[model samples]
Target chain A: MTREKIIQLVNQIFIEQFEIEPDQLTPEKRIFEDLALDSLDIVDLVTGLQQKFSIPLRENKDILEIRTLNDIYVLFEKLAAEHPDIVAKLNKEP
Target chain B: MKPRIAITGAGIISALGNSRQEVYQKLLEDECPTRERDDWADQMYGTYQPFAAAVDLPVETAKTISRHFRRSMGNAALYATLAARDAVAESGLSKEALQSGRVGCIISSTVGSPGEIYASAMAVLRNELQDLSSCQFFKIVSHSSAFNVANFFGICGVQLSPCSACASALQSIGLAYEQIKLGHQDAIVAGGSDETTPIVLESFRFLNALAKNPDWSPSELSRPFAEDRCGLVCGDGAGIFVVEEWSHAQARQATILAEICGYATNCNGSQISQSDGASIAQCMRQALKDANLNPEDIDYVSAHATSTPSGDREEASAIREIFGDTVPVSSLKGHLGHTLGASGGLESAIILEMAKNDTIIPTKNLTRIAEDCAGLDHVTSSRPKRLRTVLKNCIAFGGVNATIIYRLADF
Candidate 1:
C-alpha cells in the first residue's frame, strides 16, 4: 500500500525464497550480481512478486528494463498509484 | 566371465526404523509399525476404508540438505538423498573415487510425490497456474528421485530410473548389477523411494487392496501369509545400496556386505492385475539358472507377499512348485508393511543383516498359515541360521515380476 509496506513485502520474498540476507537487500543492490540468482530464478521471482502483490505482472513489458531492487519498489509503487483500490484494501487494518 | 557384483554398503529409512539393525530389532520384538492417521480420511471423498499406514520422516536430516536441491525434491527424493548419503558414508568411498567418473546412480520410485501432483492440479484448476512454484514440475516428474540422487552425490555415469511400482527397487538394483557385470561402471548407487500420500491410500482402498483397522488395532492389520490376512497397509520410506564391481571393491579393500549372484526380471504377459504361479515360478527358475545354482542352494526366500489374498496364494504356490516346502521362507511385509517401491531395497538390506548376524527374522503375525499359502516352510519365529544363498522375489502390478539372489561374502 505504502512505500514501506511494498519494500517489506518484496524484501521478504527475496529473503525467504532465495535465502538472501536482510542487510544485503539494499535499494541499489543489483538482483543478479549481488543476490547470486541466475536467469533460472527470474521466473520464480516474477511468480512470487505477482502472488504477493496480487497483480498480473507477466503482461507488463516494463519488467524487462528492471535491474536493481529499487526498480522493483518503484514498479510496485507505480502500480499502486494506478490502482487506488489496492491501496485502500491493503492498507485497511487486518 | 561376468564381473561379480558386491554390495559394499546399504542404508534405509522405513516405518520399522532408520537402519537395518532397527528393523531387525523391531521384527524380533514382534512389533508392527502400521498406525492410524486421524486426518487421512478427510482427504478421501467419502470413501474411507480406515487404511492402516506407517510413516517415518527424517525431518531433521531433510533440513540438512541445501535448499537449491531441496526445493526441487519431494518426500521420496529427500528420503533417497538421505539414504544414499548413509550408504556412501558406510562404504568409506574417498572423494576422488566418488567423483572419478566411474561411479553410477540408479534410483527408482513408483511416481514422484503424488501429493505435489494433486496440489499442482488443484492450482491449475483454480486458474492460478502462473503463480505456481517454478520447481513444482521437477518435483512431480518421474525421474525426480534419480536426478536428485545423482545431483546430490555428483554421480556421473549410467543413470537410470525405472517406474515399475512395487518391483521398482529390485529392477533398479538388478540394472546396477548388470552395469557392473558388463564392466561399464565401477560402482553404482541403486535403490527406490516412495511417500505415503492420501491419494495412494485412497486409490488402494478403492481397489479393495488396503488393510483396514476395525475390530483389531492398527498395528495388527498387515497379516501376510495368514488365513485372516488383510490387504497391504501403506508405509513410506526408502532404501539405497552401493553395489560395486567385485574387483573394484577388492582393490579398494572395502567391507563387502554381500555378493549379488543372480537377477532376473520378466513380464507375466497374461494378467496385469492378478499374479499367476506359472510365470512367477519361471522367474525364480530363471534367476537360479543365471546364478548357476539349484533351488537347494538357497537357504532362505524373501517373498513379496503383501498380505493380499490372491497375491500370496500365487507366490506361495510358485515357491512350492520350485523350492518344494523347504528353504525356510518369510516376508518382511509382516513387520514393515508394504513399502511399495522401497520394499525390495529395504528387505534386501535386512536379508544381508540376516546373513551377517546369523539371525533369521521370521514372518511376524503369521500365527496360522492359510490353507492356500501352505506347503512352504513358513518361518514363524526368529532362529539361528547361517544363510549363505538367499533369494528375493518381488511381484508388482502390470504383470512385472523380479527375482534376485544373494550370497554371503566373508569380508
Candidate 2:
C-alpha cells in the first residue's frame, strides 16, 4: 500500500474507533488532544492495528508516541515496505 | 502546635455490604460479595473474569448529586458520594457546616472512568462523534473522582486528587490527617474508591497478574498469603472517613472511632512497579518512630498484600524484618479482594471496627502459608482478640508506601 492509502486506512480506523470526523483528522492532529484518546485507548488502537495489519508492533514506547494519523500511516508504510507479504495480507481485507 | 486528629465518622460500600453494619456483620461471618461479570458480557472490552466486590448502588444517588448526567461517570464517583454522605451524616455535621467552606474532600482512584472511556472509544469507532458529551473528556482524567465528589458535596475548601496507584486512597487519608493536624481545615472527608474496568483487567492479564480459575467461587479465589494463591481478584468499592481535630470532634461530642496517632509515607524512588524491601522496612520504622512506639508495641497489622507473587514476598520480608514473627498480621484482600484505591480506607475502617469489637477477623482462605511468606503470625481462622494499637500499611504502583497508626477509640 502507498503512503496515502495507508493514511486513509489509519484515518478510517480513527473515525471508526474515536468517532472523529475525517476532516478533523489532519496530519498534525494529535491523537490525545484532537481525538481525545487516552493511554488505554491508544493501547487498544495499536492492538487493533497490529491484528488488522498482521504486522509485529511490539514495543510500548514507540506505540505510545504515535500522535497523528500520518505517524501511524508512516509506521504502517515502513512496515509494509519491509514485509510485502504482510501488506498483501492487510490489503486482502476491506 | 500540631492538633490531635481523630476519626469522627466512617462509611463504607464493599463486596461485603453497603453500610458499616452490613459490612461488619458480613466480615464476622466470613462472607464475601460474589464476583461475577455475567451482566456486563455484552459490553465492549468486557471479558474480565475476576472477583469483584461491586456495590448495589442506586442511580438516584448520582442524579441527586448533579442534574447533569453523562455516561462518563463510573461507579467510583457514585460510591464515593454515598460513603461521603453517610460519613457527614454520622459526624453530626449539617449542611450548614459543609456550606461554611471549612470542610474539604480528598478522594483518590487508580484509573478513573475506564468503563466510560472504553465505551466512548467504541462509539468513536462507529463514527458517532456527535453523541459524545462535553464531560466525557474530564471523566477520563485521574482526578475526576475527587472533582466529582467535591462538586457533589459543595465543599469549597481545598480539594485534592491523589493518584498513587493502589496506595492512592491511603495517601489521601494520610494527607488529610496531616492537613487537619496542621489546622488546615476543621473537617475533611477523605477516602478512596475504585471500579473494575476492562482496561485494568486486560492490563493485569497482559502482565500475567490476574487469577485465572476454572471454578467461579469467590472464597476459593483471592487467597492472599496462601501458598496456593495465584493472584488477586479485581474488586471495586469506596471507603470514606470523617477526619477532624480531636478538639473539634470533642466539642461536638461526636462519636470518635479511633485516634490518628501517627502517619508517614515515603517513595522508593527506584523501580516503578516493584517494591524495595528496605524502603518498605524504613517506612514502617519511620511510622513507628513517628508514633514513638516500638515494633513490639503494635498489637496488629493490616497488610497490603495484593496476592501478587513479588508484592506478597516483598511485603512479607519487610514485615518480618520490622516486627519479626511475633506480630499478628492479616490482609483483608483475601476476603474483600484488592479494591485498589480503596484498599487502605476499607482496611482501615475494618481495623477500627475490629479494635472496637475487640475481635480480629482472620485472613480468610489462607490454607497453607508460602515458605517465603513464613515466620509472621498470619491470622488465618477468625478469632476474637484484644486489640489496642493497630498499624495500617499500603503500597501503590508509583513506588509509594504509607503507614498509619490508630489507637482504640476512648469515650
Candidate 3:
C-alpha cells in the first residue's frame, strides 16, 4: 500500500476509536500531550493496530518510541514494506 | 475520655447544586428539581412515570486531575473525587498533610460501576474479550470509589468502602466518627456516591420501590410522608465531609462546622427488604445514649423517609417511639429524591446548610400526613427555628440502621 493509504487507515482508526475528528488529526500532534491520550488509550491503540494488521506490535519496542501520529504512519509503512502481503491484507475486509 | 469529632467542611454534588449557596437558595425556593426520565422508564420497565434528580458534571472538570487516577474511575468514583477535592480545599488542609496518609477516607455506594459491568457482559456475549481495556476491572471492582479517593489524594491511612444499600453513606460517616472518637485517627474524609444507571433503576422499579404517580409533577411524586405518597424517586450525587478531631481542628484554626457527638449502627439480621421498626428505634435510642443526651436535647430530626409506604411508616413509627410527637422532623427526599447510598451523606450536609439560616426545610410535597406516619410533627413548610442539636437517621435494605448525632460547634 502507498504511504498515503497508511495515513488514511491510521486516521480512520483514530476517528473510530477516540471519536477524534479527521480535521484534528495533524501529523505533528503529540498523542499523549496534544490529543489527551493516556496510557490506557495507548494500549487500546496498539491492540487495534495489531489485530487489524495482524502484526506483533508488542514484540518490539517500536510502540514505546512512537510519540506522534506520524510515528504510527512510519511504523505501518515499514511493516508494509517488510511483508508484501500486508498491503493486500489491508485492502480486504476482516 | 472520648475524642471530640468535628465536621470542618462538607462538599456535595447533587441534583440541587454543587455549591452551598446554590443548594440553599433552591431549598428555600421549595421547588422539586426532578425531571421526567421518560426514555429510561420506557426502556427499563415500560412505565411513563420515571423521574430522577441528576447532577451535571462536565468532562472538563476532571481534566486537571492525574490521568492515573482518572483513567480507572467510574461515575461514582469521579463524583467522590470531586467532592473530596472540594472538602480538602475547604478544610484548609495542606497537600503535604493529606499525602502523609494521616487522614482516613470512608466512602460508600450500593453498587460499583454497573455500566462497566453491563458493557463487560455484552463483550463476553459477543466473544470480544480481546478489545477489553485494562481499566475495566478496576472500575467495576467493589471498592472503586474508596480506592480512587485514596489514590487521588495519596492518602495512606484507613480506607473503608461500606455497602449497606441506602444506609451505606451514613454508615461510612458513623465509622469515621468511631475511628476519630477512639483516637485511632485524627481526621477522615467520609461520604457516599451512586451513579443513577438504568439497570439500578429497573431493579428498583421491578421491585415496586419507585413512584408511579401519573398526575403529579416530577417534584411532587416523591412525597415522603404525604397521604398520597407512592414510592421513592431514584437520584444521584456525592456528599463528602472533612471530619477532624476537635483539638486538631482547633490547633489548625480550621472552621468547625458541626461536632459529631455520637453515632450508633445496628442490623436486624433477619429480612433483607422488610424493616423492623423496633430494631431501628433501638438504634436511635442507642445513639442518643452514646451522645449522653436525653431525647429532648435534639432540636431537629432528619428522617430517612424514602416515600415508600412501608419504609415511611416504619421510620415514622421509630421516630414517634423515640422522640414522641414533640420533636420537629423533615426529609430532604422531597427535593432531592432518594439518592440511595448518597441520601444520608447528601441530606446530612443539607441539614448543616439548614442550620446556617436556622431554618427547617419542610418536606417538598407533604400535603397531608399519612395515618401511619401521623404522630410525628412533620415540618410541611419552611420555618425559622434554632437548631443547636440534630439527629440524622439512615435505614436501608438488609435491615441496616445508622443514627448520628451532631451538635453546633462552639470554639
Best by DockQ: 1
lDDT of 2 by residue, A1-94 (tens): 7786787777776776555678898888877777777765665576567656766565635665677766787777767889998777667776
Ranking by DockQ: 1, 3, 2
| Overall lDDT per candidate, in order of appearance | 0.86, 0.78, 0.85
Tell me the lDDT of candidate 1.
0.86
**Which residue pairs in model 2 clash with each other?**
A16-B125, A17-B124, A17-B125, A18-B124, A18-B125, A19-B124
Worst 10 residues of 3 chain B by lDDT: B41-50
Fnat computed for model 1: 0.57
lDDT of 3 by residue, B29-81 (tens): 98666897766664575545556877667767765565657778888888888
For residues B242-307, write the lDDT of model 2, one tens digit per residue. Answer: 888889889988888888888889989997888777888888898898788899888998999988
lDDT-superior candidate, 1 or 3:
1
A-chain TM-score, model 3? 0.90
TM-score of each: 0.95, 0.78, 0.89
Give model 1's DockQ, 2 decimals: 0.64
Flag clash pairs in model 1: none
Q: List where candidate 2 sits over 4 angstroms from the true fold.
A: A1-94, B39-51, B60-72
Model 1: CA > 4 A from native = A20-24, B47-49
